[model samples]
Target chain A: GAGVSQTPSNKVTEKGKYVELRCDPISGHTALYWYRQSLGQGPEFLIYFQGTGAADDSGLPNDRFFAVRPEGSVSTLKIQRTERGDSAVYLCASSSAGGYNEQFFGPGTRLTVL
Target chain B: AQSVTQPDIHITVSEGASLELRCNYSYGATPYLFWYVQSPGQGLQLLLKYFSGDTLVQGIKGFEAEFKRSQSSFNLRKPSVHWSDAAEYFCAAAAYNQGGKLIFGQGTELSVKP
Candidate 1:
């Protein structure tokens, strides 16, 4: 079976540029999550989606970060005015429901802001 | 708030030697614990999880973890390691009502020596 997958394994953008990272969750997974990992640090939560609506966005660092899951199967994380601070690996994961289900993670999109 | 701590930032062991990685978590209630491994340029792969029942859980790649409610810890161990096992390991925890959002610890990078 196909696991969660992210597009553009690597992305390099200049400061102040805009970028969008895509994620394709495993089929039938209703809970999706986004996390960012900085160098020498663990992954930090960003946003969570249950179905089409954003169930939790408190983890989002600031207004510059936004995400959407229109159809409930795919997700897109949008970053506005990229900064050097945003240069890190953006990870996507999905689970069957919410509680104790195992989360399947994608390869992640490494965004390097120059 | 829920959190996890991995005390070791890096560890090196000779091939065929025993291995142990420490992981401690803090949560209000009994939490769901998990171990994940990540290779360079790859997504996270689940090693094992502890939700309930047996305290000892086994996972892929000859890895296993013991969950201790008394200590609030779930440390991973292996009898012997191979060079191929070199990678980064992350310990994660999810609270009862957090809707599957995981709190990850700073990873421990394992290096194997021949």
Candidate 2:
């Protein structure tokens, strides 16, 4: 089976521009999560979705960042007025419904804000 | 707030040498623990997870981890490392109510030398 996947393996954009990153979760997975990894650091949680609604979003840094998982399968992370500080690898993961399941991750989209 | 900590920023070991990566976590109760590996330009791969049962858990690539409740730690270990083991490793934790969201620590980079 195909694992989770993300589009635009690399994206270069100017600061202040808006960018959208997409993720496709594995089939039958009802839990999806987003994380950001900066240089020399670990991945920081951003948001999590259960079904079509966001179950937890406290990890989102600010209002400038938003995510939507319409139809409970594909998710898109939207960053408004992107800053250089937003430059990092955006990773998406998915798992079967439950807190104890191991998450399968996607090849991240590296967003570089210049 | 739940958090995970990976004490080592970077480590280098000769091929065929034993390896250990330390991880400490803070949570009110026993939390779900996991170890993941990330190669440059790739997605994170789950190494192992500790939810319950015996403390020691084995994983892919000969990786293993022991969850210690008294010490609040889940350290990853490998009897012998290969050059292909060179990558960034992350420790993550999650609570039962987190809706499957994971809190990750600053990753430890491993370099295997020939």
Q: What is the TM-score of chain A alone in each candidate?
A: 0.98, 0.98
Interface RMSD of each: 0.7, 1.1
Tens digits of per-residue lDDT for model 2, A43-113: 88899999999989999999999999989999999999999999999999999995879899999999999
lDDT: worst 10-residue window of model 1 chain B: B94-103
Give the distance in Å from residue B7's predicted Cα in candidate 2 to where it truly belongs: 0.9
DockQ of 2: 0.85
| Candidate 1 local lDDT, A74-110, one digit each (tens) | 9999999999999999999999997789999999999
Which one is best on lDDT? 1
TM-score for chain B considered on its own, for each of the candidates: 0.98, 0.98
Full-model lDDT, candidate 1: 0.95
Summarize candidate 2's per-residue lDDT along B1-114 as a digit string, tens digits.
678989999999999999999999999999899999999777899999998999999999999999999999999999999999999999999897787788899999999999
- Please state how well chain A of candidate 2 matches the true chain A, as a TM-score: 0.98
